[model samples]
Target: MLPARHAAPLQKGLLLALLLSLAACGGGGGGDSSSPADPGTTVPTPTPPSGLTPPSEADAQRFLSQATFGPTQANIDSLRTVGFKPWLASQFQAKGNLYSTGYSDAIHKAGLKDFCKQFSGFPNDYARNNCWREYYSAEPLSREFYRNALYGPDQLRQRAALALSQLFVVSNAEVEGTYGLREYQQMLADKAFGNFRDLLKSVTLSPVMGTYLNLVNNSKADPNENFARELLQLFSIGPCQLNADGTLPGGQCVATYDNNGVRDVAFALTGWTYPAGGVSPWGSSGWKNPTYLRGQMLAVAAEHDQTERKLPGGGTLAASRTPEQALDAVIDALYQHPNLPPFIGKQLIQHLVTSNPSPAYVARVSQAFVSGKAYDFGSGVRGDMQALFAAILLDPEARGDNKNSDPNYGRLREPAQYIAGMLRALNASSDGANFYWWWGNELGQIVFNANSVFNFYPPDYPLPGTDVVGPAFAIENANSTLARLNLATAMLYWGGLQAEDDRPGATGTQINGSNWLALADNPTLLVDSLDKVLVTGGLPANIKTGIVDAVGVWNEKNHGATWREERARSAVYLVLASPEYQVQR
Candidate 1:
């Protein structure tokens, strides 16, 4: 870490540069809008634009910025060679990274005393803390998440699963363990490219989500409305009535449901309990069965409320139906809601592409979600995620030659994306066992540890001093902005984290400045090359000139033996810390 004293001057300089850059570029923000028509309006299919003829390296990087954690030279090469559709096909079929939820469960079964015995050198207090982190807490799981993001082959799936996790929010704050959390995330990854309905069902039945949303042992006498309300508010059809294109009617929001509706859904969804297995290490099972995270939550008929309830799209959930049947109805109602396609589509667009997509863009994706079928790897179903993802990524708004021209077309890089982008652009190497995961807390988006169900930032959060809404900017403040620059300085100038025996797997995260020494001799070439990799649409001429001039100062004759390395590091550090690179277009 860079010292506070050193960081102060650097922070001021970088902040001034960022403000100037932002002034030059424009403010960043977004909004939700679609169609003025009814929910069932069948939008005309958008024409598929022709692929880029021999895609440019910058274009490939931009696409990968949206589709994957970050882009690499190899991935850019592959995309440039085969083009977009074929590359997407390969990614869809590629094997995904597997989480070790089962292993975590095994660790839990063995008890904390036996599990902590592996570590030889540690204080007495260290044993329990270490054991809890490895076996029960979210530490190990977070490592696995970052590990896959850095090195996994199935990049699109990883990105998509991450997007899904935020929408169907669950946090380690409540469900504190590796087993259920990993299982919930794995379910998301597995079903990421599958049907949206199936993914919804899996999330609903997931013990992890159940625990988080208070859906585990819902009582018939008095129902809890936490999951039911969020199901309508955040997960599925948002609290407002939306058109087929996701726009609010009459240029104003309308309530989708009331408190009564929440109670009705909650009562309908009663009578579920944890799966049958695993001893609760904490020794408590008063309201429900002992904690179990392996299988789906089981139904308990005795605890079920058999009262008739109203569904989302104006349908009656019969009182005669079983708890399982009522659940099926609830899932069906949510899946079939017109707001689902655009609501989900727009958010996915925000996550992957620009924050403020045009209503026409949302309409096109919504149409694909409603009517488009996935012939590649799906069963040609209506709610096909494969088809949905294709619509979002391959849309005319997402691709083509007009990305950088529009002043308002981009998102502020969330901490996670910022770190990943910096590392991937520089050809950084790591085993994913480093301080990067812990740095998430510092950067304000810890993986599985969101402050609440609202996530690290609200999806529609407005950019301060701007009318537009940039979700990631919700975490962008003076402190975080400085922290970002300091991190860049530490990684580039001072050495990044070194591999040590204390860390799991003894693996470090690093980028080699020496590798860029060849290009560093020529400042213009070095700056241009780094810009192509790190900045979408390349850097502004002024910014590029400034960096090139700065890099040129470190000459072989005057700056001595470390001149080349310093030049390279300086070039990287300047670009990464620039406002030009912070807002991804």
Candidate 2:
């Protein structure tokens, strides 16, 4: 049930319209697993940095839907003008906004000092938890993420970083110190387009990741296997062996590494402590440093595991080898492992393009991951993210009408994507201070605060009563599905949140209803415009008609001077509430 305040905004008729739409498309009711495109059919390939244009506006919207936080009319126009390959090139060159260091560090420090001083006492300790939430926790970082995602020039970079964040899997829920968390995310954003090996090493040595996985104070005497186990099972390779195309070999779940191998890797990873600058709240330092998160985990030679160890995939660390040497060997073996390509590539595809990508699609992306360059990129570097993304986005399966035709080609829009997409499509603006955390909390995905290391939902999550996978749908339920409708009604019918006065530069979140209001008098035009902006192909005729008829009920004579506003709100509310808009094809 909605709080009394929100109840009034969602009128009964609108609720009925949404519920009817939900009955048709919600509940993760995915269609069969038929391929979106014929196995032999080839999409018109975009020549990178040159000849490529979206065949239609729907196609352009579809591409942006996959690659960005959400599509905007301006962005659509820009993409149409520059073409696909060129737009991707520009995004690759676009400067990234960093979260962890420099400016953000100053903000985090100030917020901590300011908020932590407000309350004094046990349990009512505002100094501890309050300060963390107000400034130093995932709250502040999540706000910045929305700002970048909503308006930053580097859309693809941010999106890639989000995907990488899930795979690398560090969260403020387990690891604290806002500075460290910000820096951790910054590293992911910075390297989102860089080599996979560099990213893997960075994740391995990161203080935030170190803290989350218990690697920070690790020593040969008490090495932690948490990081080692996840590095293989979650980050680098899966538990089962894959055939280069992401399919399990012989339809068998072969183990990638054993418990013994995990222990060996843990021993190899020992001898790391918090970075040097951290001072414990009690003023401790060195090996016992409090959780300082600003820099890479420091190496302590004396605590190193000097015994020989065999890496899981291949390679050996001889006795007397330095900690750095052993660490290098472990990373090298993992980076060169055959499992890295398809395991990482297929997941990337699921995140960016389709949920169940064809084996051929996975193989194509895997090949790109291995080569680390694309013909379009012309950069001869290995593990190139730019090349990999180009391969995924430009693939025929990601574009064309087949994406809509196939019953199983798309993914349910996760809460973040759904909210951001709606706001972006309706020309929304935000200081990004609160809606993300508030609404995201209500919807079960609060960014940097995922429920666990496994993430909000696993990549292989199967839709209910179906063989199809829709990872985002894992969080959807009776309550969340209704909450989605409630959120839409609030944004479209009522005004969105107002800016927080205490937050510097906060605009709160709001959409330009005027854009929709302008066409409200003509119900068909309003619905069509929304259909173009919000739905990926176009709204199904029945759904589109339902929204139009709902809007038409609010003619001026019957509904007074505010009729247009009512009609406009009804149209947007109904579209967002529909299952068609929930899935990103």
Candidate 3:
């Protein structure tokens, strides 16, 4: 028997807001400010390119693909009202106001300050306080490390998200802090829309990068090769061979670099270390101090390797590659390479939009990454975020021809999206850690806890002839599928609809249980709600029908019973479990 999976923690403030918002609409009788427009409610439809009164399904799909997680009735209506180009512009230049609900803000405010403060200790102090406990306990040091790293830190989420994003842009050395603290998360976010080269530099010095890549402890005599190896293989100048069109040549695979090249890069990476000691005449010890470092990576002179090194391709450089020199060489090497664009662009596209980007798609996006032609910045063409977004959304590959037809060319929904959507739909709170714990257990993917630097799964690991991507594919097997179904069932029936008292701290007070039933009683409305919150605004007819039928059956079976809420809940469960909802597009 396998262990039971769990759901993500719900936010109390969000749930309360949902309840109040719903009640203000007179018990779901009418649409409130947050309530999405009805699917059947007709308005003056726009004349799309085809001169059709309403936007084509492809247009709808494209809008959904680019704008939100997935399409929902509300999103579609907004698209219809605002038009695609305008909406695209807004999404590209999103402000804090884009989110109508305050859930994200609430989550951010919950304990971010405390989290940051806990990790703000001096590096030496931190090591002294917890290093012993970490060594003696059976629990892994990573757990304690993160606990200290993030506890009392209001910027935990932002820091984590930025680090995860940086895995895409920067070279390993720079990321490992061969650079300095110049590259923290806030700086990354602020400069996210700027030059790719700067972003790369920032990533290199980010404390997170230093800690994660082990650059903090890298020294002159024994330079750690982890950052050096990944720098070439994963970050830039990836595996061998390229097409004339600058794409990966057909049948060509990522080749391993000669050991000499690795050694040279490693040598270049030497000398950088976190600031140590207290903030005094000298700078604070880099992230390595672990006490006052606040988990940020910094360059430490003592730990840096100053040895001369030979390149794998037969070149020899003088001993002592300064951090700046190493960064310049590595960045230039990667920037000049033909493979960088396709390699990095492919990953970005997969993460942001789709998994199976076509070859043409890869070519176009890669071009933008290199030269920034389609969305390129000025002469010094670096990977600009605005350009990247344009390439992702406006590219011919992204707006596939299917949009004119069925418009189904989208990537699969990641587990994070699935869990978040369910929470929003259920209007539950993580008051007692129910939601977060549940999701961490069942989804096989957790926020801030990636299985490896490679991420939850590779975008194209399972080559046409290979089976290396087994773990990625297996996430959707029968057992996992059943778990998903069970999750949905629990949320709809026994999960969200239960009286507040049935939960850990409820005082048996029947607090607004009818909202759950009201949601179930109207299948169209229920599916529509899900469409808005979970799928964005693009529920297929088949999915809608299945949900309605499931809810109807459950409702009929339990009609006149006190547990009507459970029946309504069953409907939502069925909908979430559907294959249509599972796929991201």
lDDT string for model 3 (39-106, tens) is 12222211224222355444555545443434444455766676555555554444321101111111
After TM-score superposition, the amount by which residue 444's alpha carbon in candidate 3 deviates from its true location, in angstroms, is: 0.6
Best by TM-score: 1
- What is the per-residue lDDT of model 2 for residues 1-585, given as tens digits with 9 covering 90 to 100? 111123235455655554454333432212222333321233233343224444577878888988899886677777888788788888888885656322234322332334356434324434254455654678778888887777788889989999999999998888766777778888899988878888999999998898899887787897879999998899998898887777776778899899988999999998888776543344234455655677788888888898888897876888887778888898889888878878998899888877778776776667777776654662546577888888888776676654565556677788888878887877777876665567888877899898789999999887666666778778877677777887776766557767776554667877877777878779999889877777764678877887788789987787687777777777877778777788777
Q: lDDT (CA) for every model shown?
A: 0.75, 0.74, 0.46
Model 3: lDDT equals 0.46
Q: How far is 539's C-alpha from truth in model 3 (Å)? A: 7.4
Q: Which stretches of candidate 3 lie over 4 Å from their true place?
A: 1-72, 95-188, 244-247, 254-256, 276-321, 373-380, 400-408, 425-437, 463-479, 495-547, 554-558, 561-568
Candidate 1 lDDT tens digits, 81-112: 99888888888887856575335565445434
Runs in model 2 deviating more than 4 A are: 1-54, 96-130, 281-286, 501-505
As for lDDT, the candidate ahead, 2 or 3, is 2
Reference-based TM-score of each model: 0.92, 0.89, 0.65
lDDT of 1: 0.75
Q: Check candidate 2 and list the clashing pairs.
A: 100-182, 100-183, 372-383
Worst window of 10 by summed lDDT in candidate 2: 1-10
